[model samples]
Target: MERSTEFLSDIDMVVGPRGHRRWPDAVKAQIVAETLVEGATVGAVARRYDMRANHLSEWRRMAREGKLVLPAVTEEPKFAALVVRDDVETTPDPEPRSPLDLIFGAVTVRLDAGTSAARIAEIARALNASS
Candidate 1:
């Protein structure tokens, strides 16, 4: 059999430090913080730091899970509690309603204000069937 050495000519040697990189927790938190800025994105921040977006996302997850601690914010967030009391009585709807009257021959039917359209239609249907 003849030897084939043609494929070896195209291979180029690349020698450099290429392996897993160790990122400090503080640096990871800072990169994660950059993503929190308004209009900033994970891919953009990761590219800026020469890292992968997924790695930055993992750091963000770590920060969320308390595995990583982010720097404190300059301004404190304020939240107001909304109190709902079950002891308070419910009030009727305040919507204004107009009276309605239905007349069938010599008989007249009066409906209360705010009666639903479906109920009115049902009553009218019943009255028509009875007539």
Candidate 2:
């Protein structure tokens, strides 16, 4: 006697909580890239994937925003180019002091003991400008 074989349909496939389905990652990536980068309609991708259009659309958006859980193919290079030994090192600007420094006596101020109010105002302006 010959035995009959049954095959599972696309609908029979199950999707996991982590967004992985019975379909291969490469296939899923192709579908997503087609819809997002290729500008293919969601309905078209959905038909190709044998899924609902809305679901495919949501998946595409999620993939674009990096919300989908997918395995990394290769390790991306940390730096695009290597720095030469002779290259000069540039120093970054120091972080600005807190505003409290201006309010409190943290900042040193140098002015003549008998300096006029106008002179003091000018000195304060210069200090503020320098800051």
Stretches of candidate 2 above 4 Å error? Answer: 1-21, 37-39, 69-131
Local accuracy of candidate 2 as per-residue lDDT tens digits, 30-73: 55666754357888767666568987777667777877654454
Best candidate, TM-score: 1
Q: How would you encode candidate 1's per-residue C-alpha lDDT over 1-131 as one tens digit per residue? A: 55453442333322248744566677677778889986899999877766689988999999999999997775567688999889998999887776889898887888888788999999899989997
C-alpha displacement of 87 in model 1, angstroms? 39
**TM-score of structure candidate 1:** 0.43
TM-score of each: 0.43, 0.33
Looking at candidate 2, the ten consecutive residues that score lowest on lDDT are 2-11
Query: What are the clash counts of all predictions, listed in order?
Result: 0, 0
For candidate 2, the TM-score is 0.33
